[model samples]
Target: MNYDECHTVKTICGPHASCHNTAGGFFCLCHTGFAQLSGKTNFTGYGAGCQDVDECLQQPCGPHGVCINAEGTFLCSHMTPPMTSHLQTTLSPFVHCLSNLLKDQSIIDNCFTKRLQQPPADQFCSLINSTLAFARRMCEQKGEYRQKSASVTLKDVTSFGNKFVADGSGVESATVFLGAMENFATLAALASPTQELKAISSAHLDLDVRVIDVTNRRFLAHERLTLRAKNDTLDIYMKTVTEEQQTGASVVVFLSYTDLRSLQRGEFVTEGQPQSHLLTSSVVSVVIGNRRHRQLRDGVNITLSHTSQTQGSLSDWRIFCVYWNHSPSSSHWSPEGCEVIQSNGTHTTCGCQHLSSFALLIATSKVTPPANRLQHHGILPNPAPIQNVLQLRYRMV
Candidate 1:
């Protein structure tokens, strides 16, 4: 080889007999049987070595596996598919994906990381609670739509001045207003005595109550209703019982009407105070404590107040009507006809007969007061009696 030519390749004195060339220098390179290993060659003085190249980036393997190039050598390896996907492919629909993943937790966690972290845990829990509370308010609002008299105010649980605040240690006050509002729904344990509710206004014939509260000792929040009755019609001003609370609290409520009639007979067949028909239905109770709260471990108790107009012509009747299982599912109270169970003052159970849903053939009679009575006793009649045969259907469930 030429001594001055940079392009010439010449063999060095080292035992490795390879030759290579560079600018103004000639060096030994790998022979046909070998290739230079990586980092083996460096330019120092006149005797440096040539480094091997990694062919892995060039994908030297059959394109099905990884290629790792080493000094004068290389290796190829096949990648194994994930076990989950492997089973999915092999077993088709019969694959037991959970069993495989449970045996290996890391694989499952890595796969689901992005989906699971979309919403933080705290935000998820808060969203759930908010949804439930919103649903309760919506149901209550719908029920209040049917009230005839007396304004109802929906109170926020946080708006009350005397609300309970939990301190991880112990409750500061023995009693706190978990929530308070007009037409608020309450629920107590089903076993509690139903007759313990406070009567806001009681009329022998008709009644009107301004404020009613029923907080039982059971720590449940139930319904408390303030009502105004006119003529033979009753206006309800209260929230609809929520689906969850309805089954837990059952009470005996009373509703009084002067006469009971049957469409088949078309005549007044009976007259008296029916206690069974009056008391069996549950009335709305006011809940003063949070049913969901724990430390006020005991349920809440409430008080109710009523306003009576003794001088009015329709103030004598204080009646509470009971409509049981009123919904589209109720087949007993049909539009064509329904049964009216009447109980006289003397009998515990009243007679039952079929009548139209809107059939009220009862006489428009009046209750005569005592001749020597000093106070003016007024009897409120049904303001909107079902006389025109406009039969309405209600479900039981």
Candidate 2:
């Protein structure tokens, strides 16, 4: 049993350090607010570079609070709120300014883009949507399950923005994904299954959270719940009915986001006209768990998986299954309640019926772009065979 990759070995560790793998070899450490400079804690070879310690020298936020620091880390901010996280003093300065604007170096070399850079990655997804609008107000903090829910408040704040992700919830049980496309509130935890059985998963969401009856919310009669996810891209089937106790998690949720399209680029209108799609899959959000499975008479059967087929056109890419709306005036992505049923080039089989947040767009170009220019993708017209559909178009130059 031989292996490698202890970070591709180039002096192994030095500048600000960070290896960590342990038990079967691996260790470097020294990032969070850094140290090393030789005041050693672990070393070897080109090991040792980290320094930045001053966590505000020592004011750890006592006298009227306002630390700021920032390098390894430090940012108490304005202060006076902690009756128990006044939402970490109003979203911890947008997670410490998106973890220090991704350690800026020209946004770590133009935001490690993954492609489809809309509106020039809208100022890097508007600085990661200021942590996705406080991760959608921590998923609308509904009802009660306290202990300061959220697996016990950000479960040891495990690496954000820099992208590691871990939550370890309050009562115990963590692993909350808040790095890319992070929203839907630090994903309220639930691993407890004290028999009454069914599924509810993570790693990258796997569905079917069966077992209802929180006082006969009904469903254990002929039980029906099926969900599939673990990479192969996507596949989900739904036909659930509730009622079954031993309760813990049943606010009914089944999320799967690989970048809730961060902030969806090229958002083809749908049901309101204006088309020109290209999302091609990487968004699956089905929040069903009663109120009659969240308004489903018979729908919720998604099956997307088309990140490409040589990039566009299976009869002009047409697909659009959309959802995720708003109102205080208006938000967007509204295909009215979805229904693609079948598509080709790779996959597409939706049937939604009102849940929330979903995506599939694809129809890349038969031109269509007006509607105040879909909030600027540089007013369209680059048309040379869908230029790989908005070639990761994030423009701020």
Candidate 3:
């Protein structure tokens, strides 16, 4: 049949589409930037069979821009560049202030390298920036005063300082300078794990911390430190305290163990048996204030050290600070404020809070009763009573 005589059908292609008819079949073709509604290259139906092509799927705008799809076309919107110039101007003073506060060369180098080269994550950047800003403000506020006696709590400074150190790549020298300026109390408090000590033993211990100025040979600050230690192990605690005025200040800690059991029993052990326990280091000068020029703060860094006369023995030997408590009925030693530091083991470095009169108590290792005694009593002898008491006492130097 001829084309005209075959069939005269109504236009079936939708808008933006062209319809082509051959002998007996007709097909719809969508125009550029348009597609068939059914997602086909071509269609044969009526209605609005053509739809705008989603150019967004191709991401024509690139990485730093947004693509907005429109009728038969799409728009590319580029993002604004970051305001680094303004940020750099604002952060310069704070960066300088932080650098001045940090004395360690390595820490200073690391801090600047990472801060300038690598962009920190948003959260950490905000934290460090805010902290440094606060420190700068503090320095400014205190600058106007003539005496410069303005006091800031160590707790407040330490909270931010610790966060800065931790997020600033764990700079040890920076931490030390911050600790020294804040009066070493935070370091001392952190050195002794109080909660862990409470769970270990019931023995009562008193700690004291002192700051000595080595340059001028004088005592700066002396205070009692709340120290906690495992009751089972011989623990020593030390911290260095420094003030703004003091540069070469050293912290001296004196530890003294209190024998609560002996105090309760109205018995005081004064002299310790020589072979009962071991003494490794020679008894140094017991007077804390004697060697004013000798700096021992750095020397005494170990917070806890454990030594047994015989290895793997369950019984723990204790060193006590013994001084007259002046109670008429009580003969026990009080380890409150004596000035003697003593250790029973050799090559052992002890850290204590303050100087105090001290004594040693060597505990008996054997706790369980003999098998014959257990058989006769039809039960094991009560070990708790024997274990709680100190067996021998050694004189303090």
Q: Tens-digit lDDT track for model 2 on 59-89?
A: 7766644343433433333323322323445
Model 2, residue 354: C-alpha shift (Å): 21
Clashes of 2: 20
Clashes of each: 51, 20, 20
User: Residue 343 lDDT in model 2?
Assistant: 57
* lDDT agreement with native, every candidate: 0.24, 0.40, 0.34
Candidate 1 has an lDDT of 0.24
- Higher-TM-score candidate of 1 and 2: 2
Residue 215 of model 3 has an lDDT of 37
lDDT of 2 at 129: 38
On the 0 to 100 scale, the lDDT of residue 30 in model 3 is 75
Error of 1 at 184 (Å): 7.1
Q: Which stretches of candidate 2 lie over 4 Å from their true place?
A: 1-28, 31-150, 153-283, 286-302, 305-319, 323-327, 335-356, 359-397
| Global fold similarity of model 1 (TM-score) | 0.16
Candidate rank order under TM-score: 2, 3, 1
What TM-score quantifies how close candidate 3 is to the native fold?
0.25
